[model samples]
Target: MNDIDAWVWWLVGAAALGIPLVVTAMPEFGMFAVGAVAAAIAASVGGGAVVQVLTFVIVSVALIAVVRPIAARHRTQRPQLATGVDALKGRQAVVLERVDGSGGRIKLAGEVWSARSLDTGHAYEVGQEVDVVEIEGATAIVM
Candidate 1:
């Protein structure tokens, strides 16, 4: 009980820091845990208490400074992958029936969908290619 080394204590501290990282899903704890491991390495190499403490502080602060901004940027960035109805917008469709402000049909994204013109008094003839301006609940508004 009296013979526990300083390096062993540092490793235990690292494990303690890791517990919160896993439970809270916060990355800062992981950075601190890495720092504690660095301190443990210093202690294993016969460094004094001051050297071990400095190793922990420097490593932890460096990791936080380098990684935090990158993580924040990724969190704030919008995903680029368009999906579902959003993907259908700005796509080309073939008019299967005469399309006007009233209504018609078009083959959009390999499926036949009810459609209408985006502009009134403008019409698309059958077999004409039109752009899908927007989708409105089972209907494609075309232009």
Candidate 2:
């Protein structure tokens, strides 16, 4: 084969191999999709017709087999759970007590939560409009 044809075949083989490696390593859509498309183009242009089709099918199956377990493992490790004051952001609440520079109390979502001011050294009155900035333990930092 000519140099150009040799280069094309090399690219095809590299992509067929590299795509699966990339999918195994990162498994993200952007990487996998690009790799798959590159491999398919290379195979179609530079490989025998039957080998190109077989390579595409085999590489795709292998990528899916390898990536599926990794995705499943990631999901299993961090199974979604709901808890804590994270569930309280954006909800309206009343300042139950004056917040000193240190801390105060607020009634939010029918629950009383310890609160601190993001604007440090500023005191909030017992009845002030506040937004929940974040939740720390049982305390909600307010703005």
Candidate 3:
């Protein structure tokens, strides 16, 4: 083939490859449509018009079929959790010492942790069962 024919063929192949890559990488940029147009233009100018058109159609359809669902799924958001002490809420623990208005120790999920009671009026003795209502810095709020 001559240089012009080679350029046309190169354009055709580049469009075919670039279309899928752009669609997969940046679907929001609308590069797939641009690639499809380039492919069609290349097919008309280059030889093997029938084969080029068929290949372009097949690849464009395949890319659309594959990328749409993946893009939709990726746009979804996940729930967030509070950091630090708030993360330990709803945990069951056993008091290691008498927990009153002041600080004490507790065992939670096989790990010893510092604990305190929200109600200073109540007293919790050793081996008493409690639930972690909230977390405050390095301490657990127990009841």
Candidate 4:
């Protein structure tokens, strides 16, 4: 086919690759799409078919090699901030009522939470301090 037609086809391929990048949230597809755009530019400037193909491959591979690892590192380096009840674990609380093995109440994170002692034989009096061990349903296990 003519160079103009070939460049058009390359641009079409680039657009096709972009669809999957958007749908799947994959960065590799975006890299390939950019490579396809580069190849399209090469074809427009009178590059031979072999040169166009090589340009596409080199650009795609280089981007994948360089960008993918940086992206992965960024993904993994994000600080994992605990939320919800998971954040309550390991926090200090004050007993609002006598807490025994069965149940009681505690002031945790400014909220009153149903609490039980982590140790079956131990008990906490009102105004005692405790550490939350875990959250079980609507209750907190403390010690």
Which order, best to worst by lDDT?
A: 1, 4, 3, 2
TM-score, each model?
0.77, 0.47, 0.45, 0.78
Candidate 2 runs further than 4 Å off:
1-84
List ranges where model 4 is wrong by over 4 Å: 1-3, 73-81
The number of the candidate with the highest TM-score is 4
Winner of 3 and 4 under TM-score: 4
**Candidate 3 lDDT by residue in tens digits, 87-132:** 5689799999888778899998788889889898887999899999
lDDT tens digits, residue span 7-108, model 2: 365365556656666667645433345445655575656666566556556666776678778877897784366465556776677899986559999888
Per-prediction backbone clash count: 0, 0, 1, 0
- What clash count does candidate 3 reach? 1
RMSD of each: 2.8, 9.8, 7.0, 2.6
Q: Which consecutive 10 residues in model 1 have the weakest lDDT in total?
A: 1-10
Off-target runs (Cα >4 Å) in candidate 3 are 1-27, 30-87
The deviation in Å at residue 101 for candidate 2 is 2.6
Model 4 per-residue lDDT at 77: 83
- Quote the lDDT for 11 in model 4: 99
Report the Cα lDDT for residue 25, model 1.
96
